[model samples]
Target chain A: MPQRIGQYTVATPSRPALLSYAAAVGNKEGDGPLGSCFDYIAEDTTMGRGSWEQAESMLQKTAVQIALKKIDLAARQIDLIFAGDLLNQCIGSTFGLRDFGIPLIGLFGACSTMALSLLNAALAVDAGAARYAVAVTSSHFCSAERQFRQPLDYGGQRPPTAQWTVTGAGACVVGHGEGIAVEALTPGRVVDLGIKDANNMGAAMAPAAADTILRFLKDTGTEPGDYDRIFTGDLGVIGSRLLCELLDKEGIDLRAVHRDCGVMIFDRERQDVHAGGSGCGCSASVLCAHILPEMAAGRLKNVLFCATGALMSPTSSQQGESIPGIAHLVHLRA
Target chain B: MKPTKKEYDAMTNKASPPSPKGKNSVFAFLIGGAVCALGQALLEGYRAWGADLETAKTLVSVTFIGLTVLLTALHLYDKYAKIAGAGSLVPITGFANAMASPAIEFKTEGPVTGVGVKMFTVAGPVLVFGISASMVYGLILWVIGLFD
Candidate 1:
C-alpha cells in the first residue's frame, strides 16, 4: 500500500517514472512562444480531416504515437492507456486510440483531464497495476466551440472574459525507470460557487484551484514556497488573479511562483486569444512541451501541477445550473 | 475540501451583473439602424430602376443576404454584431449572417459534414418556428374562407 500524507497520496513508494512525453498542436498554437517545443503542429485546425472531431482524434493519436516513439516503446509494451478530450462521450479518445488496441480508460474532467489522467497513471504504476502506462488528452477549438458554445461561423462576438479552446494533444509515458518521478497526488473535490456565466470560466474555476492548493498544502504539511513552480491548468488571466486573491484570504500568497498554463501557452498581446487558452490540451501541451523539458534539463527541480476544470455542459448552462469546478494536483520531482 | 455554507454563499453572492448600459444601447442603436437603412436604400434603388414593388422587395432581401454573407466571410460582421447587439440581430442581414457564419467557419470540415451540417446551427430554430407559424396562419385563413 502507498503511504498517505493526510489526504494526499504519496507516490514515493511506487516511484512511477515519467519517462517521456510529446505534444502536438495546431498552427495557431505553433505561432505561440513555446511553439518550437511542440513535437508537431498541424498545418491547419482540421489536420486534413473530414470533421473537427476527426481532426481532434488525429491530434490525440499523433501525440500518443510520438510519445511512444520518444521512449522507443510499442503500443504492445504499454500496459494501460488513460485518455480523454473535450468532446461528447470523449469520442476523440475512443476513436483515435481504437486502432492501437491498447486497453484504455476514458476520462472526462473537461480541461482537467490531462492532470487527472497523469495522476491516475502515476497511481496505477505505483500500485503495480501496470509496468508502463500512458496519460493522454486532447482538445480542438472548432469541435469544442460547436459542442459548448456557438459554431465558428455564428460570428458571435467572444466576450473579453471568454477563452479560446486550444487545438492540441499531449501524451506522456509513466513507467518504473529513471526520469522525473511523480511524488504525490492531490485529488480535488468538486466545488460549486454558483457562478452561472459560461463566458467567465476563469472566475468560475478560481475558487476550486485555491481550495485544492490550500488543501494539498494542509494535508502534506508543506508551505507555498516548497515547489519551484506551481502551475494551474487553464485559469487564464482573470482566474489566476482571483486565485491569488482567494489565497490571500487563506493567509498564503503564491504570487511569486504561480504561473498558469492558459496564460503561458499563448502571447496574449499578439494572439487574438481574448482571455487566454483553455481546454484539456492547454495544460497538457504546455506541460509536456515546456515544463517537462525544463525539469529534464535541470532548470527546475520541483513543480506542483494543478489542472482546474469547470464541469458544466451546454444543457446545464441552459438549465441555469451553476458551473462546478474541480482541480487535480500532482507533485513532480526532477 | 468542502467550503462552509457561509463561504459558498459569500462566493456566489459576489457575482456582479456586468454591463455598461448607456454605451451598449447607443452602439446597438447606431449599428442596427445603419443595417436597416442599408436595406431601405437597396429597395429604393431597385424601385427607381423601374422594378415592381414585389420584385424590388425580393431584390432588397437578396442583396441584404448577399452582403451579410460577404461581410461575415471578411470577418467584419462580428465587429458590427459586437456593437449593434439586437439592432444588427433584428435585420434580415443578421439571419443571413447567422447561416453564413457557421458555414464559412466549418468549411475546413469538408463541404458535406462541416459546412453543410453546421450551416443551420443558429438559423435552424428560427426556420422551424417560422415555417410552423406560417402553416398555422394558413390553416386559420382556410378555416375563415370556409366560414365566409
Candidate 2:
C-alpha cells in the first residue's frame, strides 16, 4: 500500500520492484561514453524506417521488446503500460506500442517522461491496480529538430547553451517481485522563473529540479549522504552547476552526491554536444542502462532519480512565453 | 532567500559561456570572400566560353545554386556551414539551400502539403523584405523625380 508522506512525498510500503529494463539508442548515443551500457545500439538511425518519426517509434518498440524478453513475459501478461515521447501527441509511443494490445496510458512530461511514467506505474502496482506495469519513453534527434528547431539539413549555428536531443528509448517493467525496489516518490510542481530562451533549457529546468529535490529531501528527513547517488535528468553542465548553486542557497550541499544524466551520457569534449544531451531519452536510457543495472549489481544501495523537463511548446515560445519546468523524483533501494 | 526571476536570469547569463564572436567573424570573412572569389572565377570562365556579360553572370548564379543543392542533398553543406557560419549564409548559395533543405526534410509529409508548403518557410522572409525595401526605394526615387 502507498501512504502520503510529509508534504509531497508518497511512501510505498510494499516497494514495487523493477523486474527488468532495457535501453536502445541511435549511432550518436551509441558512440557516447555510456555506450556499452545500452542494451541495443542501432547503427542505422532510421532503424530501416522511411521517416524519423517511424524510427523513433521503432526505438520504443525495441526497448519494450527487450525489457519483456529479459523477464520472459508476454504483452498479454502485463495489465498496463505508461509511455511517452517528445513527439506531437506522443505519436512515438502510441504508434509503437499499438501492436502490443496492452491497455495504454499516454503521458507527456517532455524529458521527465521516464520518471513520470515510472512513478505512475509504481503507484498503480503498489495500490494493487495492476499485477504488472511497463513504463517507457523515447526521443529522436531528427524528429525533435524538425518539430522544434529547423529542418534536418538546415545550417544554423548552435549557441553554446544549446543541448543535443538524444536519439534513444528506455523501458522498465514494475511488479510486486524481487528486484530494485521503488521506495518513494515526489511529483514536482510547475516552476517558471521567466526563462525565455528556448536554446538555454538548462537554465529553465534547473530551478524546478532544485525545488523537487529540496522537497524530497525535506519530506524524507534525509540528507544527501543517505543516498549513494542522486541522478538528475538532462541538466547537462550548466543546469547541474546552477542546481548546486540554487540548493547551496538553502544550506543543502548537493555537490557531493549529484550526477546528471545529460552530463553522463556524452563525452563533452569529444562529442559536439554543446552543453550535453537533453530530451526524454537522455534520462530514460541512462536510468535503464546505467543506474538500475548498477543497483541490481549491488554497487548502488540507495539512489534518487529526479528527471526534469522544460514544458514549453514551439507556439508558446514564439509567442514570447516563459518556459515552465518540472521535475519528478523517485527513491529507489537495492 | 530564493533569487528573483531577474536575479536568476543574470546568474544564468554569467554561468553560460559566451559565443566566440571574434573567431566566428574571422571565419565568416574568409569563407564569404572565398565564395565571392569562386563566383568571379565562374563568371570569367563563362565569359571566356563566348557568353556576354549578362549571360555569364546568370550562368555563375545558376552554377552556384546547382552546386549548393547537390551539397545539401549529400548532407555536406551543413558540416561546412558549422565552421563557415555567416560566410556560407550570406551568399546566394545560402538562399538556394534555405529553400532546398526544408523541401527535402518535409517530403516525408507528402509532396503538396509537406515539400511545396514548407519550401519557402526560410527564404520567404528574405524575399518579402527585400522586395518591399526595393519598392520603397523606387517610390522615393519617383518622388524626387516629380520634385525635379
* Top-TM-score candidate index: 2
Docking class of 2: high
Candidate 1's TM-score: 0.89
lDDT of 2 by residue, A1-334 (tens): 8999999999989889999999999999999999899999999999999999999999999999999999999999999999999999999999999999999999999999999999999999999998999999999999999999988788778999999999999999999989999999999899988999999999999999999999999998999999999999999899999999999899999988899999999998799999999999999999999999999999999999999999999999989999999999999999
| Clash pairs for candidate 2 | none
The alpha-carbon deviation from the true structure for residue A122 of candidate 2, after best TM-score superposition, in angstroms, is 0.5
Off by over 4 Å in 2: none
Instruction: Please give, as one word, the docking class of candidate 1.
Output: acceptable
Lowest summed-lDDT stretch of 10 residues in model 1 chain B?
A: B9-18
**lDDT tens digits, residues A1-334, model 1?**
3578886545557679899999999999999999899999999888898888999999999999999998899999999999999898999999999999899999999999998999989988988888999999999998998889875646555666788899999999999999999988888789877778899898789888998899889988888898899999999988888788778888899999999999999998799787799999999999999999999999999999999999999999989998999999999999
TM-score of each: 0.89, 0.99
Q: Name the regions of candidate 1 deviating beyond 4 angstroms.
A: B1-30, B70-87, B101-121, B124-148
